[model samples]
Target chain A: MHDYTMPFGPQHPSLKEPINLALELDGNYITGVKMRFGYVHRGVEKIFEGKDVQKVLYVAERVCGICSYAHSSACTRAMEGILGLEAPTRVKLLRTIVAELERLHSHILWAGFGLHEIGFQSMFMLFWRERERVLDILEAITGGRVHHNYNKLGSVRYDLPKGCEELMRKNIAELEENLPGLIKEFEKNSVVLARFKKVGKISRKDAITYGLVGPMARGSGVKSDIRKIDPYEAYDDIRFNEILEEGGDAYARAKVRLTELGESISIIKQCMSLLPPKPAEKWKWPPIKTGEGFGRVEAPRGEDFHYYEIEDNIVTRGKIRTPTLANIMILEKMLIGAEIGDTPVIVASFDPCIGCMERTMVIDKGKKNWFTESEFRRKFCD
Target chain B: MKRSPWISHYNASSCNGCDLEILACLTPRYDVERLGIVLRESPRHADILLVSGVVNMQNKDRLKRVYGQMAKDKYVIAIGACGISGGPFHEGWNMAGPVDKVIPVDMYVPGCPPRPESIINAIAKLLEGLE
Candidate 1:
């Protein structure tokens, strides 16, 4: 078979987002992979400059559609860190509740997308149907289905409203009843087994060395879940086991997310139980001053880290490192020897949110760069 | 028979909010298929272009190429704040939209990410206008 090169995406049906992949193929097996991004760059970090903390919160939510709340929470925490203030116990619990719900929504959406990639259209539709239930609860709470804009510096935008508890409990019960059966069926399905098992295998050492976070790392049995390793918000108070799998393959990663759905459900239930009588939590804005802080949250995809330097309540310098950016580089190595047919599944397996990860790419020049908050300040603001 | 409007979607630097809602519109709950609306992967086969996100320099030409390849009677419906306007990222350095600057848009659905129902409504309205 002659060696042939094929370009996939930047625009393709398999990819939900635009990312161009250059594949060098010898017959069906991939000999090399080159990735090109910047198709979805919205200039988020650049937008952050000169924006006040409160305004940056809204912009942060726009960072990633799937993990909007995670970015906002990270942004809030970073601002709060700068102010040397902490949200009250109730506020932290509220944030955790939304955070877990976001995780559930994101994972289910991913499952549906994964199923679609593998030609399991019915299951893909089923996963999305399940996703709507989660979205209903989120909409009920945040009043926005997709972009919650729920986070604030010292408190969330809205408190848990009356009758919200019953709604949560009802959905929790439904998800609990349905998710297990869905996952069980998925596991037993021969097609899923054939497609997922041993494909795109990542060893434990590579998972660590590559600095993988979220389910990608956990699937390889790396203890890199930020919620477990370094608890933030109400995570320390919430009792849930960190999900792990040693399969180190696509199946393992999928299992990690599927199992974590149960963990997220339990965590939401716990947050409800811990809900305070008067959950309307808020704090006064402090006097304008200058400081810098770092915030890290375990987003559905993985660790979402944000750094900010606030000067007079406006962020003069900001940096965001979403999990996809950290997890994406490893794709080059993983794709080198895989079957061409397995490419979409492998890419989908990574859950590449190109929009979220495109903050620092310039396709015209083929340059990729990330800046620390301090370095960013010195280079741009100073 | 009024054929289902085959549509192609392009994400132009969007956060995926509107894009997800578009996906939802096709799923079982919204089931735009019942309305005879099909999502096509190729622009040539599509009668309408469903565009989401803010336009940026990098994706601007690509979005145009996508729009250009569509059928002559192609209808462009810009979804969400980023579609009609850049929304939050409007002032961002890389922004090249509010999509109309890149291509003529027939309709605009408003939301940070519009709900799936709203997206269905927009399509229905578009169909009505077409008649």
Candidate 2:
């Protein structure tokens, strides 16, 4: 009948970024979970208060590494809306290529992390190996691996280099050939299935109630993909199904992301072939003006939303709502009855990026103190 | 130098870009494992302490605590521009400083998110210095 507390992270190996979860345990079962954000806060919104609209796009892209292009595209979209400009058709296709490519890499990365959590080390290696090809395609087109900085106000920074499309097609073909087996292995492998199936179940009602987005909602059959509901970029022209699952569990989320890898690859191929036969720069916009607008893009995780208020061609205020922020509350519901061992995988399954989730700036009074773990333990425990 | 080196990774207020690339080093293509670099889940087992991102006020203590936990002879490699000098977030209110301000840095890998090949090269250069 006794419950004791244990800390999960700010620096635990299971977490990819800095975020703390204070777990209260009754025997081996997690009785309660308390999450603390702000470890990775860098005053991003405050930083956007008065910066020029064009420069703010660079700041926007850095909000999260994996979804850099999504953030940049959304920023430019919002800026374009403010200016009442429509980017060239070729530019839209180019944006779609990078956005879909970002999705491909981000989903594969998440799948690898999930595999790592389930103790499937080889699968982790295999997925990341496959992810390298995606990253190569990104580098070949955007000239940067992580922060592509590819989006400008009314156009992409660069066109697909000579032979880049062929390279992309070749890589996508390889990924398509290999991904089915990976999915099969995930479904058929006893350990992965046992660890993942119904472990972090979320009902449709609960998913809707929690306001989940992206795969988190779709996995539970909520039909919440922003791209499908409200198309952007060249998404309006693309023909692809919104990959969904009715499972509402960890396995379901994984399945949605894995299936989306194929969807993203297909979307990119379509964009490449459909690229308007004109220069992207021809879709240029007039000089900036004062207005307010909203930008939304379906990032690898979910719907990435950005709001901008411009005054005299300067961004007066900007707000970013990353998918991880929307999905974090579901962890409280999912962890209520989960075994303690399930904590890491459950948290990982949500793909929580604390840096992206927390955007506030708060001063810590005890910032100067440096206490070692043993010292803290000795002081607090003994 | 031992054929294999155990690496401990810490993210001190990073944007998560470089952290992912550090992870990519473990994948089969740019496999840092071939050079015998294993990512240790604990600081005590590490020979190379890999620090990513800028050190913020909230994380500075934990970063120092983690570094303190590593073995005495460990090499600390600061990965990405933020880890070196706070990158684009240099003037942010949350930044305490770069990773070097909190602990001694042995090598610096500069990139928003350095390529896996570049990360591998940094590790190789560090190992070469060990000789």
Candidate 3:
């Protein structure tokens, strides 16, 4: 080891979010990785407290941008558990469809990001271009493309909007037509394979030890898909297979996600077939009673868990364990003993959401807002 | 289109909504590069600074340092409601304030996350005002 250390970012090209990592290098090879969080911390759990029960639903969705629907799903399910409300089958089906669509867009976004890191700009652009179809489908249903505020306590805010079902079917068919070719191109690409295969290989044992979830663990042939293991929101009613890869490397994880995209498409189809014309349950929310509830939903990254305590129609306490928190544990191990050239590829493989994980940070008290924009300009901008 | 405004993006504490939209504008469908606008990597090379999310204690100073790194002609655009006024997370215990609190903002593009079209419109407006 040369024992030289270099800082990767709090702001850098390869990283979409702000995260600083100190890397110990031996020439072009990285020997150690020390990750520092807290850049995107907003104290969401603290923010959830004392908020109205129905209102906290939106806050939970805001927890992770990629997994917004999953967080809202988890949050709603938990509050439903506390309220003892069993939403009708139709509601479950709608949620499942939206959730699967979210996975579609999210996986595509990840693919674009992964391709971008490997410098395959055309493929990156292609992936994102395809992603817009899924986003358009989502916008047709929820009225908002990215931040869909669709979920409510007892029922969704609205029934599947008129004509949205047709829109969904058309988009799904188009994506079904396009995905195989894209995945085939991705797998066959020499640059992608060379950069990804056997890079950051993890054993099933290490994945288990590190408690890796989502595609990270699934890549190692671990069948830990919460949708299959502990089905929620019509997941049990749907027919789909859990995609797994035995390779236990970056390519394997990416393969698992790409393969799962097909499976998610199937699940959404099943949900559409199962969705009834009538509203499943009314949108009536009862008075919030004092109780504790927990929910688990398989976010795109992994299993996202939410716990909430209600008192007199307001949240008294709340905690969220996002998938990124679990998946990021294996990142430091993956980076060790690897060439520094592969740093971005290896890090992007984890799809780390520091915003979700950094929700837990040491709050700095007495840090109050100071000065307006003009005041700051007068003092600082030169 | 005088000098091709090169843009840099920073996330203070976003949920990724606006950030994703900003990147979406660069894709084939929106393809802002065709208009000669490039998304640069370094703040030093950027002419326009796109800041997303609410400012918090951990990132407040980093935001300042990043703003300082950009050249004097930098145009700062606060993206999304969070960037403008902290949005739904204004009550966050760790939130320092909006983007404008710590740095001067030349434009405020509002939405929980403004669409890719909104971002494109912001860039056009920026160019028009620049001329």
What C-alpha lDDT values do all the predictions have? 0.89, 0.86, 0.88
Candidate 1: which stretches are off by over 4 Å?
A279-282, A363-382, B1-3
Better of 2 and 3 by lDDT: 3
> What would the per-residue lDDT of candidate 1 be over residues A52-108, giving only the tens digit for each residue?
889999999999999999999989888888887778888889889999999999999
lDDT of 3: 0.88
Candidate 3 regions with alpha-carbon error over 4 angstroms: A363-382, B1-3
lDDT of 3 at A180: 92
- lDDT tens string, model 3, A75-176? 998998988888888888888988999999999999999999999999999899889999998998898888999998777877877888888889899999
What candidate 2 gets wrong by more than 4 Å, as runs, is A280-286, A361-382
Cα error, residue A184 of model 3, in Å, equals 0.3
Query: What's the lDDT of the predicted structure labeled candidate 2?
Result: 0.86
DockQ of each: 0.73, 0.59, 0.54
